[model samples]
Target: MAKVDILNTKGQNVETLELNDNIFSLEPHKDLMYRYLDMQLTNSRAGTASTKTRSEVRGGGRKPWAQKHTGRARAGSIRSPLFRKGGVIFGPKPRDFNKKLNKKMKRLALKSALSLRLSEGNMIILDDISFDTPKTKSMKEVLSALDLTSKKVLMLLPYKEEKYENVKLSAKNISKIKVIIADNPNQGKTNVDGLNLFDLINNEKIILTKDMVKKIEEVLV
Candidate 1:
């Protein structure tokens, strides 16, 4: 069994939450993690970059010169690539750069990412992160206590409820803080068959729950 030091609202240790060895203690597949990270980065790329080709450029429909030129090379049109106003040569076109991974591979990648957090002591277990009202200042205090003022912080709760209203409202406005409703981000096995788990990589802090920990553990292969 593995254990993660549990913390309270004050950023004080409550206790070590016992973790299933299957989830938090296993070795991460370096290759899989790397591959998933690479794919995620590629998929995130807009890949909308494009340029018009010479002929694709507007105007220049009329021929600039006839077959017989005045001691100069014959020109087909001014927009020809051969000329300054010509369309681009092999210009880029919009494309999908997304890389797909098998459901199993994606799960493995997410597991690897989680495992990394555990090993690095970046994973935190909390009894529960609740709020009485939507107070940005209170949430800001939580961030400060965790020393996550300006870092990319991901706060996970066990489930979704009205209690999170304040936390959500408080953190949502801040670009650096992201509060994930457990019910949403906890899509444990929705697409377990066809996954892109690479999205779980590089997060600064991970909240640990027995249920989520178990799910992440079950997919490790």
Candidate 2:
């Protein structure tokens, strides 16, 4: 088990939390993390880029000129790749870019990413995050108190509901700061299941609420 100090909004250490070794103290699997990241990025691609091939272009039914008769080189369809306004050759076409990993592999990769952050001392445990109103200044004050104003941060909340809506709004406008909810009320998904390797590795620091930590351990254990 590894212990970390839990900080309040004012940057004061309120208590220490014992983390699950299985999730936060294991050796990081660099290769798995890379594969996980690659999978995520690949899956996110729209894959909508397309180009017309010579056969797909219009007005290519008739050859531009007789072959070998004119002074110019042998002529073909106007849509030939060698001619101007011609269709592309071996060009990109719309296709699926999704990549799939087994559930076990995804879990292991997420744990590896979390452990890497913990080992690097880039994980911050927060007692709670609350906002009375959707105000950016309040979020900035908390970040300032934690001395993370300019740091790239990823904050995870346990749930997305009315209670956390203000907190989400407060942090949305801050550059380099991303806020994600572990679970949505309507989805009924386990909180820690929402943790992904990409956000875990992309951010310089991770801020997890106490509830979020427990939720993560419950799932990852």
Candidate 3:
């Protein structure tokens, strides 16, 4: 088990939390992390770039001149690929760029990522997070109290519809701060695919609420 101090919004130590070693204390495999990150990024690509082929272009139905008498090579439609306004050859087209990993692999990668963060001492445990209203200043004060205002932060929140709205609005205006709702399809199981590796790597620190810790343990363990 890995134990971390739980801090309140004021940054005071409210208590301590014990984390499951299987979820937060594993040896990080760089290759696995790289693969997971690549998969996530590749899947996110829009892949919408497209171009028309010669046959798809307009005004190409009729030949410009007779086949034998023209000074140039055999006459063809003005929309030939060789012409200036002609359609493109071997051009890009729309397609899906999605990639996938098995449930086991995804779970292992998430554990590895969490382990890496813990080893680097970048993980912060929060007693809880709540907002009276959508106020940016309140969020900033909390960050300052935690001595995290200067760093890029990723905050993991429990999936509570009412509790999230204000927190989301409060943190939206802050630069270098992101909030993600912890979600798992199974009632008592965990799913790791929802996590984004780029965001995890890009942020300097991670803050998790107490309920989030329990939720992760319940699902991952």
| TM-score on alpha carbons, each prediction | 0.79, 0.93, 0.90
Off by over 4 Å in 3: 66-70, 184-194
Worst 10 residues of 1 by lDDT: 190-199
Q: Report, for every candidate in turn, its global Cα lDDT versus the true structure.
A: 0.67, 0.88, 0.83
Deviation from native of the Cα of residue 191 in model 2, angstroms: 14
Question: Which candidate wins on TM-score?
Answer: 2
Q: Model 1: per-residue lDDT, tens digit, 26-63?
A: 68888988888788789889999998887578765787
lDDT digits (tens) for residues 1-221 of candidate 3: 88889999999998998889998999987787888889988987999999998888886588888888657788578788888889899999999998888877877888788889988999998988988788899899999999998999998887745566588779999998998876645654443224556777779999888998888777767
Q: Write the per-residue lDDT of candidate 2 for residues 21-117, one digit (tens) a residue.
A: 9999989988888888999999999999999998888765787788875898887688888977788999999999999999888889999999999
| Residue pairs with backbone atoms closer than 3 Å in model 1 (clashes) | 53-87, 54-87, 54-88, 134-166
Better of 2 and 3 by TM-score: 2
| Cα lDDT, model 1, residue 155 | 65
Which residues of candidate 1, in runs, are more than 4 Å off? 182-201, 209-221
